[model samples]
Target: MKPLQTWVPVPENSDFTIYNLPFGIFSVAGDAPRAGIAIGDQIIDLAVLADAGLIAPEKDYFTQPTLNRFIGLGKKVTNEVRLQVQRLLIDEDSELKKNPRFLVPQSEATMHLPIKIGDYTDFYSSLEHATNVGKMFRDPENALLPNWKHIPVGYHGRASSVVVSGTPIHRPKGQVMPKGAASPVFKPTGRLDFELEMAFVVGRNSDLGESVPVSRAEEYIFGMVLFNDWSARDIQKWEYVPLGPFLGKSFASSMSPWIVTMEALEPFRVKGPDQDPEVLPYLRTEGPKNYDIDLSVGIRPQNGEEEVLCRSNFKYMYWNMAQQLAHHTINGCNICVGDVMASGTISGKDETSYGSMLELSWGGQKTIDLKNGATRTFIEDNDTITMRGSAKKGDVSIGFGEVSGKILPAK
Candidate 1:
């Protein structure tokens, strides 16, 4: 199919094309945040469109600060709304082309967290990333734990600290055991890291005792976003022996403002890596469950040029989103509309494609030489980390914009 042509002039390089109408929350001046769709370099204000009687919902879902309420209306309503907006963009004689109030320049709009995430889960799904970390920390021969091939390993994460892109995160102070030391010392994290990832937003709610089947897992998903799961390696290393991460990861996680819908990414679906051991019946899924998205990570030193740290892809995951969601609710754990589930550290087979400093620096044994003449084993204060992702197949392209966070000195 040809890319949807619109009267609205789209820059060739812009991520928002007529075919990719990602949604978000944005505000201008002192106005309250409202739902909007990204197209080219402009944000089509859904609230304005709703007010103009272009696309109406039963409730004022478009005027809300988060997309959760609008999404809770179900995919049938939300998808129709997106299709209506798409039609308006392509129709040359439509009122949208003549109206200036319905559109806002993206530069002027303050993007907010698209969803009010009620709960967050970070999954260790990437095969290469899991293997690399296991080799580094665990025995080389026995990298994967026993249950890795059977289930999608994940930990419930702190949702309150999750922030939108451009939020600054302070280095976390926590206990770390020094080399040749008997006890751990509390200090600002010396080995700060960033995990390049993609996360899906849950759209539908489930009952407390009902389990969502693997085949129907996609029904619960709304869209995807670039997620940067910030980490303090030292703190995690010391505390993650019996239990998982706490202060190290709970400090902050950043998310892209725009949410590229699952429907938009349908064209880019591809087969995921084959599981060695067959998954349980509840976790079994068919079809191309994974998406072929290009992902990259970059770091910009304070007052320096941004250098690409690594290049990876989402298809490297050992477990797909369907399996993750299936396993998550298999035990009858209910999920809410704004719940977030992240694919942790999407690393590839090569060292250049490693997702975190822990892998690229070989557990701080080597320093990553930067283009700005600075070297890094771990993130330093004032250094900014940015993650970008996109899916393309011929003329159709979908983008997740970017999630960026600058590290600040610990208070």
Candidate 2:
């Protein structure tokens, strides 16, 4: 099949190809943020088109500051709008093409958080990541917890702390127990790290006491984004005992501005890793559940060039999104629109493919050599971490552009 063609001049290697019309919120100089779609190097201001009666004429969801309203319209309307936008972009004679005012250069636009995330959940879905961490902190012979294979372990995260790409985060301050110390000390974290992840946004809300089944999980998900779940390793180790992550995680989390819809990723769908011991009937999925998204993480020093630290893939995850969602709501927990659920630390089998500094550096026991002759066991102040992801198959290629954050000294 021929890839979709747009009138815009998209570079062959650009992530925003005609086949991928990812959505985001953008604001030009002196303008308020509004919904927009990426096309090549330009952003089609959906608000402009909607105001001009070119699309979604019956509704004004595009005028909103975030994508929550538009996504809440459900997949039928959202998918229709996506298809119509594709048609309009491909049709040279279409009014949208003739009206240049509706298009804005991406360089001139400032991106914002695409959605108003009401709740956030981060899941430990990567087997290798889990094993690595377990071996470091627990018994090497029994690296994986017994319940890991049967269920997707996750914890609710701070939605308010989730920021958009380019947002600088302060190094989190928390209580930490130094090696061989009896009590903990409260101070800025010395072991800040980044967790390379991908998150899906929920489009439809479920009533309280209602559960979303695995079979129809895709229908509820709007799209995905590259996520960086910043971690305070020392703080986490000292506090993560009876319960899960808290202040060690809640300080900050970052995500890319754009959301790549599931439709754009359909071509890259693949079967997930085999579930040994067989998952529960509720967690079983019939069709392809994993996506073949190439993922990588890069770290740039305060004054040095970016160094690619890790290369991994979304397919490395043992538990897929569908299973995670099903397990999340199995106990009659309701989900809301704009909820963000992240795939925790997508590490592969190889050591270099480890997702976090703890795993990649082996809990700070080893140093990762960088280009500037600097070595790092954990993230340093003023260092920036960026994560990128893309799915390419045949002529179709789409991507979750990237999410990056520069670390600042704690106040």
Candidate 3:
């Protein structure tokens, strides 16, 4: 397939390509937030296009702060809208090309959370990440747990704290058992970290007592977004015994505004790592379950230069999204549209490919050298963390812009 040239001028290496029309909510000035598609440096306002009788369905689904309603309309309608935008972009005589009002500059528009999440689930699916963590705290020889290869381990997380990119997160104060302390002390986290991840939005609702098969899991997914699952190492280290993450992780999580649809990612699909001993029937999946997305993390201190921390790929996942969704629903758990399921910290084989600061610094034993003559084992105040992802094939590229957040003093 050849890359389609658009009349809309796209700068070199811009994430928003003509072939990738990611959806998000955007507003300029005092106007209400509405659905729009990202193309180059401009946002194609869906509301304006619908009102102009150009590429609308029976009714306008773009008049909302959240894309839940529009996404709930199913992929048939959503994919058609994307196709319509693609057609209009390439055809020079189209009304979209004539009227530039609908194309809002991304600089002027404010990007918002694409969906109102009802539920959130974070999965520990990366073999390298799990093994690295196990080696740090548990046994190095038996790094992987007994059931690690069998199921997609996950836990429910706080949906209320999930914010869009540029949102600031304050250091969460919680109980921590300091080194050699008899008891725990309540204070701000000494070791705050960011987990590089990707999350898929649920596009359809499932009925109670119904299980979606692994083969058909993609049918219920709408799109993907770059996710940053912020963590407090000390807070989690003490509390993640009987139950999983609480205040340590619930305080804040950030997501990229634009959602790169599964349709757009179809070209970048590849087979995931082989599962030894084979998965259960419910978790079995066919070819090319994982996407070959390049992921990177960068951190910048206040008034300092940014430093790239780690570079990993989504293809390194031991468990894929289909297995996660299928395993989640195997017990008859129903999923709703806008429910986010995050792929836990994606780590690779190399030392530089480690996802979290805990792994990168070997649990605070070593310091990470920064660009501005600074060193860090964990995040500091005013330190900004950004995560970006992109998938590229022969002639096509799809980007999940970025999820960024700056840390603030503990409140």
Candidate 4:
């Protein structure tokens, strides 16, 4: 497909190209947060466009602070708006090009969480990530649990603690069991880590007791974002026995500001890893279920330069989003429009492809040498971790710009 030319001057390798119109919520110095779409280095204020009678004039969804209302309008309206915005951007003679008030420079705007998340679920979908963690903590021969191959394993996450990019996270203090110790001690996390993952936002709601089959699962998906599932290894190790993650995970999780629509990513879809021992009927999906998005993680020490730590891909996931959603609602569990579901810790076969510090450093048994002569087994105080993702084919590319967070001392 040929690149869509626009009247705006988008850089050659820009992530926000004409082919991509990712959405977010942004506010100027004194203005309230409103819906906006990224274009090159500028953000098109959707609220202003709506007020000017360009798109969705009769509806007030575009003027809202969160994309939840806009997304709730369903795919038909959202897709039409997207196509109209694309046409307005590319047409040189359009009136939108003459008005500069609706365009805001990205540097002058503060981005907020794009949606009001009603619930969040994180799925253990990557075979390599699950297998690596299992080998470290459990027997290598039985790395995967007996039920892992049959179902999409997931845990309910705290939606209230989910923050947007650039939010600072304090090290969580929790009980930790030391080596050969009879009792655990309460202290700040000694093993702080970040998980590289991607999440999809739900656009349509499902009623209780009504199951959404695999065939209709994609229709409910709104978009995708980069997710960082921060972890405290010691806290999780001590607490996770019968019930899954709690305080160790509930403290905080970060997501990228912009939500790249599934329509924008349709061109980059690819086949995911083959599932062995075959999944059940409900989890079965056809066509390219996974997107070929390249992911990377970087760490910057207090006063040091950023060093790229790991490289992974979304295609490595053993269970795709469709399967995850289908399994989620199969048991009559209801879902809301702004619900967020994540693909947990995407890792590959090699050491450099590991997503989290626990896997990359081999459960703190090894040290990762930094460029400034500093080494680390896990994240340190004042260190910033950034996660980035992009999907490209030929001349067109779209990205979920970096989701970064700095660690502060425990409060």
Q: Estimate, for each residue in 1-411, the C-alpha lDDT of model 3 and write its tens digit.
A: 566889998888888998799999999998999999999999999999998988866445898999999999999999999999999999999999999898999999999999999999999999999999999889999998898988899999999999999999999999999999999999999999999999999999999899999999999999999999999999999998878789789999999999999999999999888889898888888888999999999999999988899999999999999899999998999999999999999999998999999999999999999878899999999999999999888879878888999999999
* Candidate 1: Cα lDDT at 168: 97
Q: Give one clash count per candidate, in the order shown.
A: 0, 0, 0, 0
**Stretches > 4 Å off in candidate 4:** 57-59
Local distance difference test scores for all models: 0.93, 0.92, 0.93, 0.92
The stretch of ten residues in a row with the least summed lDDT in candidate 2 is: 54-63
Question: In model 3, what is the error at residue 369, expressed in angstroms?
Answer: 0.7
Tens-digit lDDT track for model 1 on 315-344? Answer: 888999999999999889999999999999
Q: Compared to the true structure, candidate 3 yields what TM-score?
A: 0.99
Residue 290 C-alpha lDDT in model 4: 91
Measured against the true structure, the TM-scores of the candidates, in listed sequence, are 0.99, 0.99, 0.99, 0.99
Reference-based lDDT, residue 284, model 1: 85
Q: Please provide the root mean square deviation of candidate 3 (C-alpha atoms, Å).
A: 0.8
Q: lDDT by residue for model 2 over 346-367, one digit each (tens)?
A: 9999988999999889999999
Better of 3 and 4 by lDDT: 3
TM-score for candidate 4? 0.99
Instruction: Point out where model 3 deviates above 4 Å.
Output: none
Report the alpha-carbon TM-score of model 2 versus the true structure.
0.99
C-alpha positional error of residue 71 in candidate 1 after TM-score superposition, expressed in Å: 0.3
Clashing pairs in 1: none
